[model samples]
Every structure is written in C-alpha cells, then in structure tokens.
Target chain A: MIKWVDVYKAFGEKKVLDGFTLDVHEGEAVVIIGYSGAGKSVAIKHVVGLLEPDRGTVEVDDNDVPTLPRKELYELRAHIGYVFQFAALFDSMTIGDNVAMGLRKRGEMSESDIAHRVAEALELVDLPDVQHQYPAELSGGMRKRVGIARAVALRPKYILYDEPTTGLDPVTSAVIDELMIRMREKLGVTSVVITHDMRSAYRVGSRIAMLYDGRVRQVGTVEEIQHTKDPIVRQFIEGRATLEGDAASLAAPGPAFESGATARGGGAE
Target chain B: MNVIEATGRWVRFRVEEAGRAGRFLEEAALAFGSVRSWLPNATLQMRRLGVDSLPIGLLIAVFTGIVLALLASYSFTGAVPLYFVGTLVEKTITLELAPVLTGLALAGRVGANIAAELGTMRVTEQVDALETLAYDPDSYLVVPRVVAGTIMFPLIVGVAMIVGLGAGWLASIGLLHLSSDEFLKGARMFFSTFDVEYGLVKAGSFGFAVTLIGCYKGLRARGGAEGVGNAATQAVVYSAVMILVLDAFWAMTWLHGRS
Candidate 1:
C-alpha cells in the first residue's frame, strides 16, 4: 500500500537518506525502530507526503504522492491519519473540537454527524467525558489519547504514530501499547509506528524495521529481530553499549567532549 | 524582592519582546519571499484579512464623515466668513478626514483581527501544520494581507471621501444657508489632481504597513493568553507608530515634489 523507491533526502550539506527504499504491504503494522536522528521520522514523513524525496518517488496506493495535485494530495492524506509526537493538540480548542477538526474541514458532514463521530473517536481511545476539557488541562497521557482519537476521527485506513510513548511513564507506555494492540484488532487498520520503545514496538508491530544511519538494517518479525545476534544490533538493544575502542575514540575527540560537557551551554529551564 | 525591582523586570521582558518582534518581522519577510511554490496561500490570506475587512471599514468611513462635519461646524461658527464654510467643509473632508479616518478604522477592525488569527495559529501549530501540508505558510498567511491592504485601503478612502463631502455639503446648506452648487464649486476649486494622488499614495503605504505588522506579530505570537495579548498590543502600537512616521515622510516628499 505504501512504497519509498530509491529515495534521497538532505538538509544543506548533510545527507540524511541516500538511496533508501522500503515497502509496506496492505493492512500490515510496520514499526520503524531507530535511535534519535536516525531518520525514522523522516521516513514516515515521506510515507505521508509531508516530506518529498529529492531524487525518487513516494507512492501511496500506487499513485506518485509528490506529483499529485493539491486537492488530490489532500484527499489521499485524508485516508492516512497522523499522530504527532507531543500530541500537538490545538491548545486553543477543546478535546472535542480537536478531534472534530478533520471532519469539519471535509465540509460534507452535518454538525450532528460530526459530533457523533467525535464522541465515538474519543470512546475508541478510552477517553470519555474529557471532550469539554482543553488540551492544556489534560495530562500528557490523556493528551496522547486525544491525539489518537483525532487521528482516527476520519476513519482513515492507515494511521501513523510518531514516538507515541517517549515522554510517558512506564505504566502509561504499557497502557498505550495495549491500546495500540486493541486498535489493530478492533479496527483492522494498517499502522506505522515510529518508536524507540522496544516493548511497545514488539507489542504493536506485525513486522519491525530497524533503521540505522538512514537505511533499513533489518526488517523481519519480532522474533527474527529479537533473536538476531548481530553485534551492532545487540549492542544497541543492550542500551548504549560502548566498546573499548569506541570509548577511546570518543575520548580522543577532545574538543567534541569538552563542548558537550559544558553544563552552562546545556538546555535552559 | 522590592516592588520597583519587580517592575523593572517586567519592563525588561517587554523590551525583549520588542526585540523579538523585530526579529520575527525579518524572518517572516524572508520566508514569505519564497513563494515560488505556494501562491494560493497568499490569496487565501487576502480573503481572510482584506475581503473580510470591508463591511466594518465602510461602517467606520460613514460614521467618521458625519463626525468630521459636526466637529468642523463647531470650530468655524462665527470665527470665519460664512461663505468660506462650504469650501472649508470640502477641503477638510477631502484633504484629511477621509483618508486618515479610514485608516484609523482599519487599525481597529483589521488590525485586531490579523493579530488574533496569527496568534492562534502560532500557539496551535497550525502554521507548522501548513508547512507540513507542503504550503509555504508565511506567503499564504501574509501576502494576502498585503494585497488586501492595498485593495481595500483605497476603496475605504474613496468611500470616506464621498461620504465626507456629502456630509459637509449638508452641514453647509442646512447651517450656513449656502446652496449645494456653491459649496461643491468652492470644494472643487481646491481639488487638484496632485492632492488626490498624494492621498492615495499615503493610503497605499499605510495599508501595507498595517497588514504587514499585524500578520507578522500574529504568526510570531508565543506563550498562551499573555502572548496573544502582547501580539494584539504590539500590532496596534507598531501600526499606529508606522502610520504617523510614514504620514510625516509622505507629507514632506509630497510637498517637496509639488512646490
């Protein structure tokens, strides 16, 4: 249903993706796993036509996404829902309005019909009675639920999740994982989840693709990935492993170390 | 902390925002310059700011016409020759009241609106959403405002000129016992093509500055309610300040060119 063929993308002098290609079958749940800045987000952004590949084509339902007219592109996008990281709910709106935004923009549905669908979407995300509340008033976990509800409000055939559980507590993350499983079971919709949370990826992904340095290192079932003894993969899975050689090299980059170590140069509160 | 020191901090933050506003304008102008891809957004922006602003702009013109006449009658009562009242009415309405009042009207109606819309867009990620949707948000959001300002400023100025002239005629005929024909002749006596051209130039420049500053503040709006409030305040402040400065500049150049 989706394909990225020989894609190349760059920002100024830095090449992010070079000749990257991938395919996702119909109704398949594909999870993209990678470390930060590994181009996981960029890859999904291509699938949705949010970012166009410079050299190659992205196809949704066999139609070249970048070449589609504005109306056609919007129509195609209507079938694919997106849940952004940080929820990105409209802070100016109530939860109900946020979910209703997609439907209202279509301008074909009646007010009553939109209201009913919004309620249904919220219910699907296990959120009830929170429609009247603003996004700023909700907990982070609850806001993610609103984001999920809004993404699914259009009854899209596909949904994309970008780092869904990154900022959540462990328990909340587990809850979100369960919800993802139930959504696939209940809706039978195709899902593309970009995540670093291994447990969540395992729970939700029918097939997992591990992206490293802007290319797919491996794509297989959860067992295939988990059991693979590839040293680089295993080391990353072991959580931030550093070989003696890596430590020596990282240590030897003196200016780099000193720059990173400056506490005063770090993020402000 | 002492009260004075706390107030000083507040003042510093305000000063910082003024600096931020200047930076936002520069960035927005640069971003809007990249309209090679997205042209429709500029039109949509026109619909929102310029076309939408017409009704209230007209209302303001009409009211100002009547008020200008009423105020002028008081000042001219027995202080000047009665026959000169008709010409004075025409000159004041044509030369000053029409263009200036129309601008003031827009400052309230269109100015407040662009600020709020842009401010809301700033906080809601709608601006970023536009970028994600592959449309250049600034060009879409701003260029329309500029176009609308250009189109509507002159239109409102025209409306104000006509109504103000008519109101002045009524006042002169009713109060000063001058005939309509006499008043119109004297009003037309001072009406040079140069004066008309100069007023249009002022209107065009004023309108552009108002819309540009208004939209820029909105798109760059931050924080929550406080941020929006600041954008609104700044929109009005910057627009008003720019208007006075530009008016002075135009007046100097116009007089110099004519003389």
Candidate 2:
C-alpha cells in the first residue's frame, strides 16, 4: 500500500500540493483526477520518491519513503514502476535495451532470463516486433507502450501512471487504457493512475478521487462520482466551463475528508 | 534601498548555486563506487568524447602550429638565430598552447554535447525514469562522461602535442630556410621532460573540469527548449572559463615554484 498523509509541497511561491492526501491499497486501481495544475502528477511523484514533500510523510508498506537510506530507498523503488507523462524513453537505446535496462542494472538476472522477460513484456504490451527499433522511430502512442513495457518488465508490485492518456487521440487513449487494465488483470499489480480523462478514469478506476486546491475534493466509486452532487466535482466530471461566481465558490474547500487509510471523503472519511 | 535589496539577493543566489554545485560534485564522487554500472558507458563515452574529437583537435593544432612557426620566424629576423624559432614553437606548444587550445576547443564541442544531451533528458523526464527504475542517475549518466573526459583528454593532448611539433618542424623547414638538424637541435636544446608532463597534467585537469561543469549544468536544466539551450551555453561558457582558470592555476602552482 502507498499512503500520502497531509502532503504539502511547493515550488518557490507556487504551492503545487497543499495538504494533499491519498491512499492506494493493494490489488486495486485508484485514479486521481484533477485540473491541469491541480498537483495530480506531483502527488503520484511522491509515491516513487521523485519529489519529496515539504511537510508530511509518504509511506509505502510501513516504510517511511522520505527517511529511508539510499539503499533502502532504491530497494523500495524496485517494487514500484512509474510510467512517465511523455513516455521518457531513452532515445539512444533500442526498445529491447530500454525494456531490459532495469533488470540489467540489478545484475542478478542472467542475459537469457532478462531477454526472455523483455520479450514477454513487449508481447504483453502488443509491441512484440519493435524491439530493434529506437523510440524516435515509433509513434507517440507506440512510445508510450514501450514505456509501459519497460516498467512491466520489472514485474513491480505497483505501477504508477502519470497522465497516461493525456496527449493521445480517443482511439489511442482507449488503447492505453486497455493496456492499464490488462496489466492489472494479468500482473495483479496495484495501480495509481493520475489523469484528468474522465473516460479513462471511469474505465480503469475502481475508485476515482478528485483533487482540487491540492486536496481531495471528493473520493467515491465510479458510479458515485459519475452522479456526484458536489458542484465542483460535477462541473469537472461534466467538463463544464465554470462561470465567475461558480468559479469563486468552486475554489473553496469541499466537505470531503482530507485523507484516510480507507476511502476518505464524501462520507467515507 | 531596492537596489541594495536586489544586489543582496543576487549575491545570495550565486552563493546558494555554488553550494548546490559543490553538493552535486560530492554525490558524483560517491557515484564512482558503482564500477559495473558505469564502465561500459565510460568506454563508449571515451570513443565519443575523445576519439571523435581527434579530427578537430588535429585541425586546430595544424593551424596553430603553422601560425606559431610563422610568428617565431618573423620575430627572430636578426637578433636571435633561426633555430630559436624551433625552440620557441616546441616550448609554447608543449607548455601552453597544446593543452589550453585543445581544451578550449573541446569545451565548445564535448562540453556542449554533454550539456545538451543531459538537458534534453532532464526536460523529457528520462532522468526521473532512471531513478524510478532504481538506477542511480549519477552513476548511469554522470560518471561515464566524467571518467571519459578525465582519462581521454591527456591521451588526446599527447597526440596533439606530437602532431603540433611535427607541423611546426615542417613549417620551420618549408617556410623558413632551416634544415631538419638545426630545428631538431634547437627543439632538443631546452627541452625538459617536465614540459610534456606539465601539458598532460593541464589537459587532464581541463578534461575533468569541462565535463564536470557540463554534467552539472545539464542535470539542473529546467523548463523546455530554452532551458536546454541555456544549459548548453552555460556549459560551454563555464568550461571555457574553467579551462583558462585551471591553466593559470597549474602554471602558478607548478611553474612558479620550478622557475
């Protein structure tokens, strides 16, 4: 389980995360939906120790992420896979090398074992024949799949996706969404998906949490969020442009619970 | 009051930036402990940063040798013997010109390359991906470039030294009216093994500084295209300046005591 407790982070004067909190239990997919600058990516980054919180603790399986030593932190990270917003594939490397990079670095697995795993991962992502190609040769959607293959090759216990469907067309976005679902079903890995795509959220998430003003505006099942009574959550889910008066009110905090180990907020807190 | 406040803030920013760079160096030093992680990459980097840089180094050395020979003969018209031109070329090429000129040239090429590559990776989040995969960015990305620069520079300088001297010797014979024996005699007259050693030392230090500064500037790049551009520019500018600084430092520390 990954737990972010009252996490507060800022870059200079811009407070990207303030009192942000979420809990991702094992064997389930939790999607964090938020506005463009609502700190969705920042919150997920804390999971892999990419960005440290200014105030608060991020714990994974009872280990405090911030306080862990270098060896321990890296050990903790090996069990977690993070798919980047832009795929972030190493352009210099071929697809096979990119997929095999993490396993090769661990130095425990033999070359044949690593190759087998890499081949299996690419096959899982429906990219079986592109191992010899570089990332520059692939399309945006293909590169994203390779990124997923790279992560999945590690066989991590948890996978974090950052805006996995942000830039793709509807068809490509749906393809990535299916890949996410397949990873969950096939690998049984816990997932924390950060995205504002409502369709993706509904499709992939067992629980969807709305982040606004660096806090969870509402957390509920897909059915509940689909028919939420909260004006802010409703406006976001419906993709409605807010009027001035509604915008002012929407900026205010909601009554959702700040954070909890179980479902927190909108009566769950 | 506002001017004073702004000035103070600027100074504080520089101090803090320096502190951060120092800390980055410390981390890079620690990253060297992971030999297996960086060794293969270092060999590849050696080829890219050193062997590939040879043509340019030779090109610059050839022109510089011709110019030094011409200038030496011009200045030695009557007062000094023609052979002193050989002595002057040998000393200047060995002690000052070879390492300093080649380092500055490579600071523009290799330094900018390192900075631009790493900066692109930074903006693209490849470095973050490496970290999430439990690979140390410092070990996987930084140490190879730093190690390549530190080791290959002296070797490149050694070749450049020989090529430059050979060019000068040819110029002394072809352009001036001196024979091979006279030029060779003058060349060997005042030569000490320390001259070559001093040049190699400076070249090695130059290599280390150029790549280190490049890696440092590259990894800290922010934003997008503009950030990468700024990092490449800063890498070139800072490493060029560092080359000159290290040149003077080595000259003062080693040559001043010897003289």
Which candidate ranks first by DockQ, i.e. highest?
2
Q: Cα deviation of A179 in candidate 2 (Å)?
A: 1.9
lDDT of 1 by residue, A1-269 (tens): 88878888997687777777778887788998876787888887887677888888888899898898755887787788888887878776799988887787676799999999999989987897999999999999999888888888887888888998999999989878877777777887888899988888888899988776566767788888888666445544544323212332454576544543442123221
- Tens-digit per-residue lDDT, B1-259, candidate 1: 6999999999999999789867766755666556643354556655766667667656665665556555656677778645555566666655566667677667766777888888887775566544443344555577767767866687667666776677667766776566877777767766777666667778888788888888888887898888988988888888888877887887687666664
Screening candidate 2 with a backbone cut-off below 3 angstroms (N, C-alpha, C), the clashing residue pairs are: A257-A265
RMSD of 1: 10.4
lDDT score, candidate 1, position A94: 93
Best by lDDT: 2
Best by TM-score: 2
Against the native complex, each candidate's DockQ, computed on alpha carbons, is 0.13, 0.83
| C-alpha local distance difference test of each model | 0.74, 0.90
Tens-place lDDT digits, model 2, residues A1-269: 99989999999999888787888889889999977888988898888888899999999999989888888989999999889889999999999999998998788899999999999999987899999999999999889889889999999999999988888999989989999998898879999998989999999998999988778888989999998888677767876544112332344334221221012123322
